[model samples]
Target: MPEAGEVAARVAERLGTMRGAPVSVESARQLPAGASRATYAATLVDAAGVPEPIIIRAVPAAEDDGGLGAEAEVLRAAADAGVPVPEILDVGLGDDSVLGFPYLAMNFIGGESIPRRILRDDTYAAARGRFVEQCGGILARVHRIDATQTPGLDELVDPVEALHALFPREFDAMPAGLVLATQWLVANPPPSSPGSCVVHGDFRLGNLLVDADGVAAVLDWELVHIGDPVEDLGWLCAKAWRFGGATPVAGMGERASLLDAYAEVAGWRPTEEALRWWELYATVKWGLICAVQANRHLDGIERSVELAAIGRRSAEQEFDALLDLGVVSPEVVPDPLGVEATVPDEEPHGSPSSFELLDALAGFLRSDSVTAEMSPQVRFHTRVAGNVVDVVRRQVLLGATHAAESAQRLAALGVADQRALCDALRSGELDGTDEKVRAAIAADVRARLLVANPKYFAVPHP
Candidate 1:
């Protein structure tokens, strides 16, 4: 994370270049919960003494590239195409005389990005009704942006091949339900579409800024690419983006309504088969992404409680994949806890038990850190830390038994470990539909959720 002083200095320097005079940064602060890049909202006074509110999107110094320039170009193209997007002001700064990292500045638009607020808040009820159709229309316009018009965005490839490359080493070792879905995807590839277009690689509810008027602007263009357009549509409907709402289209609009809106604008609707294929792919892709986020924390690249907590969410995606694949029924099974095992209290003279210490830490984070007046980033991470501790507490209570049961099931299926089983399944050596294989995979997924997040199972699945 860049220091507030550094970010302010960089923004001021960049503003000077654009305004042809020295600029003063009045305030700069990091936004909360940015997963990939550091985002800052700043107020600047130009040479003319005109105050401007801008958002600075920058990558860490160690990972800086000229990608911001390309992103600015994409944003311009999107605006020209009639898509709702933030206005790009400047790009490609971070020289020795300016900011220390490559960054893009854009005019910040006021709106809400939280899914729950957009979906449930009475103030946004009218916006919610129009969201699916509006999003569909916006996406159609985005896809119509000719690839040739934008430079440096020609890097396009098969979506399936792209997904295959995202499997991290950790995923291979654990072989969660994603292994089964990936195998099926490889065997049953979707019919290739004939052309490519600009895709909002991360189009979904949270990425959209909304108000009473509906979506004001689409944000997060870091993953923008030229690919199958349906990729965006499918990602929009992914269960991970739903935020606990039952509606499939971003937890607000029905799938059919979204498709109908898209068809009216794009002149064609994606087939049911095509949508299902991509939706399943989205699930697997999110699972792999969760694994990668976790690995970043584990490997010490960027230690964050948020990243660690997201790692546990990979199992939720895996469970969703199983439901989509029909390998597991959508019907909820009874909780794995048949009878609670008694956890012994600390010995008379022993140190505090592991659970006791973890519970205390979790309570402090929840009760103190959250209510403490702090920066949004600090408060968000504090809550995430509390959640992490709670997950660890569950693991402490249930992990050993879950592991023992998983090991026994794997042995009965003639696999020495999860890695071997994944290899067999991926290689088509094992019957994916075999009762034993499905049972073992389902059982493992359930046990994982029981620790990682039990609320996931409580949500109705279709």
Candidate 2:
């Protein structure tokens, strides 16, 4: 993370060059909540003494973010198509003299991006009711953008193929359910759409800014590409994006309402079969992404508690895929184990126990670290850290038993370990119809979810 002073200085220098006159940066601060890129809000005064609020999005120097300039172009094209998007103020600032990293700047638009708030807060109740239709219309407009107009934008030839190309290591580390879903997708491909257009690679509630009127603007165009327009529709309806709500469309409205709204504007509605295929694809895509995010942290590319937590969430997506594919019943719960509790041996004990130490750290972060003195970004990260500690605490208590049970289940399946079981499932060596395979995978996912997030099993899916 860049210091606020460094960000301010860079913004000042960049503004001076853009305006061809001296410019002053009043403040620059990091914004919370983006996972892929770093965003900074900067207030600057131009030579005319006019103050401006601008957002600068920069790719971390350590990561290969291939599309900052392309994202800017896509934003412009979306705006030209009458889609609500932030105005792109500047682009192509790759030189170290400007920002020390490639960045794009845009006029800041205000609205709420948090899904929990958007879904349950009474302030947004009206917006929640109308957001689905609004998003449907906006997505229709975005999909209408001419692919030829955006010459350099990448095309998603095959989403499944694209996902396979992501991890060249043969996916040995992924969850069995995800591997199974990928194989299923390969065997049962969706009928190709006759033509292609711009598809918002990620169009979900968190990426949308909602206000009382409806969706204020579509944000995060980094994944923008040319593909079947229905990809966006299916992504929007994905269960993972639903955020625990029973309703499919962003957890706000019915799938029929979304489809109806899209048909009203786009002149065609996708068949239920096509939508199901894409929805399944969305589940697989999200599961793979969760795995990749976890790998980023585990591999030391980015050390983040949030990323590590997201890695565990791959199980949630896998369970979702199984539910969608009819491999597991939606009501399937983790089977209770009957292991006898073992008493701890006499302590050659030291200061604080591991559990106590983690408890203390989590309590400190939650109680002291999240004060007003801390920036929102810092506070957010502190909370995430606290949550991570809590997860570790749970793992310390339950992980061993969970691992033993998982191993026993895999051994019963004639597979030595998770990797082998996943490989077997992927290669179609294990019959999907076999009750033993289904039960074992379900129980395994249940055990994993119990360690990762017990709340998932507590809440019923819609």
Candidate 3:
């Protein structure tokens, strides 16, 4: 694989060769780092002309990110269907040549992400409302796109099936509790929708580009699938994406307005029950997705505080889902996984493991060197390392208690064992056929979270 430097060199060479003049790299900036992909800000200038800035996104070849070509196809299809997006200049499916990573380049939409920064402002709040309106209008247009034209559209898995297929693999390497939760979710598939549209698997604020007026570009199509449109709305309104947590609505606008705008475009309103159901499902789905990344960190695919910090947010999401389901009253939601039963005040037996030692070392490095002399990026990584230690320590302290409770709860439901319970949960063996089983699983999960992190239970009030 080409290193970032090697890739940059290739980018410079490619621009120079294309423009027929020597091109200099004016600037290159890596955007907010994440586990799934890397993004870069690139500006190039040729001797014959002016500078042009472009955004470059690179993903691992193995990911093949079913979303890539599918997303490009969706954007193209949406454009024809009348939704707005950035002009795609080019997309590259890597072959160990070009850049050693599957890459896509698009004209950098000139705007900040449509987020609270705009939603909180008096001048921008009105625009924010319009922005949500635009999102609904745009999504309705996206839904109108002919799925047959989008590659892999027919292969798109329904929400339940997709979750069943991906969750085990995603959380396979994580703690047993996550695996258990994944099983329970798969087992309890909701009422399936006959309406399959080109769904933006990740339609949320952070993925959008916005100017002072409205959405300039809808970004991140990696998870785009031909599934239920309500999935998009649910995902958008999901709590995790509601950064700062004040926006009761998706991306900080009212959900009703967003839905009403969609009705305006589509000629029919999506049922509130359907939307709410999808929203609850999306919450668990996203939380499970985050759990996978947390596992990656635990497994050493990457050590990052941001990823571990994000792992903590999953409990918060579970609380939101519980509230949405009406299984728990908003004011009475319990503490996470009985955290009081976990998180110890003393060290464990025997010699500290390498992770623990590295954690200690990272802390020392943070205080003595990182905080004092390192660049922001280096400091950020140091904090990530520290956070990883925190997450691991917390899990080690709390996990066994939750796992034991989970096993007991599953057994009480007549599940022979954890694996059997997981299999039953994934195979639809416990849907309408097993209401008591589902209730038991939900109760156990709630109790586990209460024991794990209670502060997360309090949903942010507007």
Candidate 2 whole-model C-alpha lDDT, 0 to 1: 0.78
Can you write out model 2's per-residue Cα lDDT over 352-441, one digit (the tens) per residue? 767668778887888863566887887887788876786776676677888899899888889999888877886778875578998898
Instruction: Report every candidate's CA lDDT.
Output: 0.80, 0.78, 0.65
Which candidate order results from sorting by lDDT in descending order? 1, 2, 3
RMSD of 1: 2.5
Best by TM-score: 1
User: Per-residue lDDT tens digits of candidate 3, residues 42-137?
Assistant: 787778668778887777534564246666677777778877776665666746336755777666778776466665667565567577788888
CA lDDT of 46 in candidate 1?
77
Regions more than 4 Å wrong, model 2: 62-65, 170-172, 329-352, 368-372
Q: Which candidate gets the maximum lDDT versus the true structure?
A: 1
Tens digits of per-residue lDDT for model 1 on 103-161? 77789899999888888899899998899999889989989986776766744475656
Tell me the spans in candidate 3 whose CA falls farther than 4 Å from its real position.
1-5, 61-67, 114-126, 146-149, 168-195, 295-314, 331-384, 392-454
Q: Which scores greater on lDDT, model 1 or model 3?
A: 1
